[model samples]
Target: MASCTRKLYHVHGFDPRQHLEHYFSDKPDMVFEEDFLIFPIENLTKTFLEGHIRGDVLIDLSLGSMIHHLYAPSEFFKNIIILKVRDRCILELKRWLNTRTGAFEWGHATQLHINIEGKSAELQDKEGKVREAAQHVAKCDLDKQNIMDPVVLPPADCIISVFLLDCICKDQDDYVRYIRKFSELLKPGGHLILIGVINMTYFTVGKDKIHGFAYDQDLARKTVAAEGFVIDKCVTKKATGISDLVDHKGVLFIASHKEK
Candidate 1:
């Protein structure tokens, strides 16, 4: 039986559409909308509303092709740069940004964001703002000194990474190493916003199960502090969705600023 068991798929082999459908679709049975979508947006909106996280350029390093978390940041930041690990993820994002055919629908997420902000703007207008703010989308490699390599990026005022580390990092050392890299991308006193699953070992994307770095809030807090970040806010939500797609105990959101 052990010999016949299939190995877990790598993060690079991710199918964007299938992953999106399983976790981000509009169907009633899908439970990730609350933990993955609404939770981050709400926390981000609140953090931005407090008026401390100011920046001209914001860098986003997230998993797959997610854009829901950018709606609020687009309103605050002048420029948004998205870095993806996989080519397919980059293509998927471009399809939506360019308004190409077969792009995944994000109207629900847009509406939710607008509703939370109590704004009366049209959904299309908000989406257009996101597209305009997101001026660049490029591929990145975590193993490199310069993640973008060849094309050096100016130090951003803020960086928002959602669920990417959990999917990519193999162990605590990898997590800390990547956190240091994230520090390198920011200017002094710049902010770092991270959203990830707590104590999650694995998550399913399509037919393949992918590894998730099993970590808790304490590790995240200590790691960030060790990397010269001053913790500003940390929030966690217990898993409410009764689904077996992922064995996540809960979701975590941390907002910190790099020390000068």
Candidate 2:
């Protein structure tokens, strides 16, 4: 089991496209669509509808090259800054942002956002708004004092991190440390939206089996509180799909704010 488990950065076989398709694509039989795409989308839309998370800038530190989670936030925030850990993930996002040939089609995600909001908007227009709102994407190193070192970033009003900690953290302490780093990127009163897996030990990206820290909701709450965050809401959805690609028991979503 130890030999099979690989750290995220060391997994050179990680395929961004395959990763997206396996978990996020609009497939008829894909079980992950509900957990990875719909669950976050619905919860995020609900949070945004409550009018508590809007701001001038929102920083996203998500796993892979996913943009599905940003659809609702794009409408509420004036600017979105994305920080990616890998150059491949950055290039994958840029392909869609620049509307280059062979970019992964996200029309399905855009349509889902529209349908959930019960609003009248064309898919192309909604996609454009999300693209426009995403003003910057840069590589990040969580180990550094400044995650985006040499490129000083202003404190954002909100930060959304999806499934990143699970992939990067090797233990409970690492999770706590990363959460503290996340808080530092936000303004004192800013919000933090986290969507991650629960009791997940590993997940597959292409042929690589990357390590995931198995954590429960209690640990998440305690970690966030210990890092100076006040939890406003916490939601969990049990895994309804059976797949060998990932061993996650459920999905966890937390909406919290840094204590001022």
Q: Runs in model 2 with CA error above 4 Å?
A: 1-3, 9-13
Question: What is candidate 2's lDDT per residue for 86-151, written digit by digit as tens?
Answer: 889899989999999999988888888888888899998888888999979988888999887788
Total backbone clashes of model 2?
0
lDDT accuracy of residue 225 in candidate 2: 89
Model 1 residue 111 CA deviation (Å) reads 0.8
Residue pairs that clash (backbone atoms under 3 angstroms), model 2: none
Q: What would the TM-scores of all predictions be?
A: 0.95, 0.96
Off by over 4 Å in 1: 1-11
The true-versus-predicted C-alpha distance at residue 162 of model 2, in Å, is 0.5
lDDT of 1 by residue, 103-215 (tens): 99999999888888887889999899999999899988778888888899999999999988887888999899999999999999999999999998888776667778899
